[model samples]
Target: MDIEIAFGQPRPWTETVAWGPYRARHADLFEFVMPGVARYTLEDRSRVTVTPEDGADEAPIGEMLVATVLPSLIWARGDVVLHASAIARPGQNAGLMFVGASGSGKSSRLQRAVGRNARVIADDSARVYLQDGELLASGLPGGMFIRTHDAADSRTLVSVPPEQQLKALPVTSMLILGNDDSPVRRLTGVEALASLLRHRHRPRILRLLGTEADFIGPLGDIAARLRIAVVGVRAWMP
Candidate 1:
């Protein structure tokens, strides 16, 4: 089997790896090679060769593979994968990203912002890339998901099925939703760095790769170039 993703340019694959109901291909969509012993082969720019290992059931593997590979594919095409939610609008050069623990109101705030006319660049994950030294945020193929009860009340909001809602957004402005009722405020220097560190992706993975320092350098650069904030909500809006 084969899968193709067209992001302005065509990426084709021909290797087949069956996992659960999904089969993944080693197409040109990947910029980095698969880490570890997960076998894969690329054929006809459209198919992948997949051999399931013992205990490696299909469903989890399929989900893990996509999550691991999609970002590299997106980055290969000159996009940055941010672990946050993003929103933007006309006249704004960059967007805002909200990141926090699950049920932290990140999506709810973004929904509110969208209702206020902010264009959603991405709901859960934001794709950011630097062009001519300027960071720009772009939308992913998904949208934010709210609860069914909230969904009915937010008919005017741009939403999608719960399963398809995103949890990451491109990094423009990093907002950490505080549990308290304090007002929102901008953070810089150490405060900003601490906040970003709290939300870094796969912290253990980076440590194992010995890339923690390398990762921090770039994150610091991003923090310096973009706005970072922590906002407090009075209640569980969602």
Candidate 2:
């Protein structure tokens, strides 16, 4: 495992940056307090400690660890945690990613891809980083969380899971979800770069951590290599 998770009391912060009652960070350790749920401590991108609160069980806390805590740790570092979902064809290691604002149907499109026998690379928060002169994505294995009848409620769709361990996969295709007039249009040069920057996870955290500049080195390469395009709902063909 790339990260180790433990349940215990978190250590106190030496220097703290608190944005609100729920968010705070210091050095390489990050803290998230989900009122009455759990207190999560993400340290140095490798370990997370969950301290239960208000008699909360391990299930919900563990869920939040994957959903929010893990992503936050990835974002805190120089790497890019995208607001995206991805799937790759059987026998193919590379992925086709769907990226855009949250609730822009990334989850639904991911579901559709699953129905077609595509393997899920990431459900919502796609962890991408540069390694060995290429952009590699982590196959974050877990249930596919999608919205249900109620806007506030979510349901997990079980599909063929990725390998039990985390491994990197190439992402050669990317689609930017939007309300464009065209059915599908490939982006290039400045257009593609702009679209990618707008879809990264939690820009606010980058701003807070002052590591936005750290990812600049990889952004250009990702935009240049991936065949990114703007596609509307139901426009994805093959």
Q: Which candidate is the best by lDDT?
A: 2
Alpha-carbon RMSD of each model: 9.1, 2.7
Q: What residue pairs are clashing in model 2?
A: none
TM-score of each: 0.57, 0.86
- Provide the overall lDDT of each model, using Cα atoms, as 2-decimal numbers: 0.52, 0.72
Residue 110, model 1: lDDT of 71
Q: Where is model 2 poorest over a 10-residue stretch in terms of lDDT?
A: 159-168
Clashes of 2: 0
Model 2 residue 182 distance off true place after TM-score fit, in angstroms: 2.9
> What digit string (tens of lDDT, one per residue) describes model 1 on residues 1-238?
1245322222444434443332334323222233332434333445334544455555544443444444433433333456666765434545667787866677667777666666666654455555577766655534455534554434222444444333333445666778788877889997787776776533433332233565566667667877877777663232
Clashing pairs counted in every model: 26, 0
Which regions of candidate 1 are displaced past 4 Å?
1-69, 72-80, 90-93, 139-141, 147-172, 234-238
